[model samples]
Target: MLTQLNHIRARRADLRRDIDVVHSFEAWEESCVPSYCHPNWLAAYVSWIRLFRAAELARTIVPAPARILDFGSSVGELGHLVSEGGAGYDFVESDQHSADYLVSRLPGARRVTLEDAPEGGYDQLFAIDSLEHNENYAELLEVLAGKLAPGGVLILSGPTENRLYRLGRRIAGFDGHYHETTIYAIEAVAERLLARRAVRQVLPVAPLFRISAWARKS
Candidate 1:
């Protein structure tokens, strides 16, 4: 774990030399992935571990030889992990700076627009900390579900927005103003289009964030 954190810190330093990696949530609302490399342990831990935890769950549920799409993938960190896991990777990043950074780092990983994401192409679709930022998250869920191949999984990770989550956000130096909704609301609509398969909490105690996997309903 220490080795991984060291690697991420080094990578963050290297990336910041040429591009902007958002340190605080206020700087760039769209791309806060860089906060994973933050010096503050609490902030960095909360930011990065969700991806690791989500990826852990994904590996357990998603079959091998997978094609993965990372929705709202900021700077391709999740794409990096997916590629390392031997999956073919694609991503959607609307922020130009983050997209440019993603391209530079993972040139082999294709970048596709959400609308252009091929139907029934991906075995695993990841929407990590991305969906709740949009007001149209419910509609977005429908589109994401459509992109999955038969029996494929959609992995979602988002803030719980409960009091504990709120306190953690404040402690991590992030204001929760950017989010348009909570994970519960997103999951409420997701239930209509997909069936929940697995769920895990970010922390052992408080449900600060949820990492869940779902499959399209028959």
Candidate 2:
């Protein structure tokens, strides 16, 4: 148990270092305003940390060199970390401006639209913070799951059904426009996924503000 705990700590340290490297990139700096809408570096930093942790959790299920698809990859922030382990990363972004920006930021990663996504199926699929934004989340999840390879893993991260996150956002003065709508309960989503038998393993990630689910395809 101690060894496992130490390993988790080491992994977190590595993720932090990776996020630091991402912050140092010229493209990351250039895309800040368009991505976050303002120059709130602290908020952006926290976002990166959350994304990094999500990616790390995904890595535990889907190892390196696997094909990865990031749905609604705004500016490809999480894609950067997921792609680092020699994975074939492809991202879908509906917003043309954000898609175009990602082209320069994520050089090798493929920038695709929902329609243009490859049919071959991906070994790992990420929908970090994207599910909450969609009203037709159930349909979207089904569509995404259909595109996953057999035994592939799906990683989802979003704000929990807690008011504290909203309060914190207000206190931090972060942009609230995108978060105006209600977010679905993370546990409800997980239960739905389990009921469908689409995923064999549905593991929940920690950190109360945001919750991550690692679901291995059945």
Candidate 3:
């Protein structure tokens, strides 16, 4: 186990050093994929799924048309799952490089554009850690509110500042600046985005330091 972990750590070491944003499809395909480094597939998978825990939780809520969105979908993990039913999967990604990667993974899903996202709109909305990648966290829910069909479901997942996160970062030697925010500390941050009468559900992905929240229109 230790040996395997070491291998993953080495790969992550390379991925951690730079933040030169990937700018285009060509660069993403030719350069990004080659440079894409992940140390542990299991940990990576957990992180990928953590981003969209909201989508899964949304399943418990009822909606119409079931239109879905994978916000900030890197390499398309959520897209791949959505494509299983060939449902309407809208992958909204700002990074052209990662978006391109998502396109390849989700050939059937449509590219969800910000303009196309309607107000009070989608029947089913889900995104993983992708929401945090953007600057306007509050604006995100407002946009989704309009896009959802009435009585729709919204699922979103990300980290909650906790002891597990600290340990994970220490073990992986990766930065946790963005993920360490406590959900309780900023509890109202998301509450402010929601409708007054909606139903909500919450789940914790332990050790992963992940939280998924589900809200249903009233």
Candidate 4:
């Protein structure tokens, strides 16, 4: 069942998603950053390839599902990969331009209605590089915690601002980009947050400096 709105927003207000910072590809399209980021997401592909590793970790834990919700998904990059893995997924994006490109892939992606997400209990939920966009990151996590099915898993990947990825860029010489809540230390910090939130597990399996945790509701 979906959580109530005002209460949910109020709960979301308590969390702070400060920077810990920091994905792959179909054809490089300005509208679809996720697909454009695909090739760069996997290991040994992009120059700074930890992003790809993040996707890998998520793929490893998220089992095949009848229904999947790819939150903040851009142009279905990882969504398509998961689909190929034998799971059906629904890509959710707030931006219509990007969502339009994603729909080209599925030919059925509906526009995200902010009041509530696509209905039904999904087996999997993913929010990559997305939490910071919320008030900080807490509100987003609260919503995510409420979204999962009893045993479903939610995968979140992001940088803790300026700290995690920028230092990595020094050695790699990649240009620094902007991210709201980037963290250089995710393993310890994220593990703590996940535990308090009542998430069943916190697995940091990635080449990326941030985090990719699998939270299951029991």
Q: Residue-pair clashes per candidate, as listed?
A: 0, 0, 20, 35
The lDDT of each candidate is 0.80, 0.58, 0.52, 0.47
Regarding TM-score, does 2 or 4 come out ahead?
Answer: 2
> What does each candidate score in C-alpha RMSD?
2.3, 7.3, 7.4, 12.8
| Model 1 lDDT, residue 115, Cα | 84
- Over 58-166, each residue of candidate 3 has an lDDT whose tens digit, in order, gives 5556523456766666555555444454367777777666666556545677776868766655666765544554456667656765566667656655555467766
TM-score of 2: 0.68
Candidate 1's C-alpha lDDT?
0.80
Over 1-218, each residue of candidate 4 has an lDDT whose tens digit, in order, gives 13323322332232112111121122223222422222233321232233344445555665556667777775555554455532466666766655765666566544454246643366667776665545446655655556666556666666543444456545443443334454333223445444322221112342344445555423
- Residue by residue across 148-207, what tens digits does model 2's lDDT show? 776666776666535666675666554444542333454365556632222211123323
Candidate 4: residue 202 lDDT (0-100): 19
- lDDT sort, best first: 1, 2, 3, 4
TM-score of predicted structure 1:
0.90
* TM-score against native, each model: 0.90, 0.68, 0.66, 0.59
Locate the minimum summed-lDDT window of 10 residues in model 2: 195-204
Off by over 4 Å in 4: 1-56, 84-87, 118-120, 162-164, 167-178, 183-208
List candidate 2 segments past 4 Å from native: 1-42, 85-87, 175-177, 180-187, 194-208
C-alpha lDDT (0 to 100) for residue 185 of candidate 1: 91
Q: What does candidate 1's lDDT look like per residue over 124-174, in tens digits?
A: 899999999999999899999899898788999998999988887777667
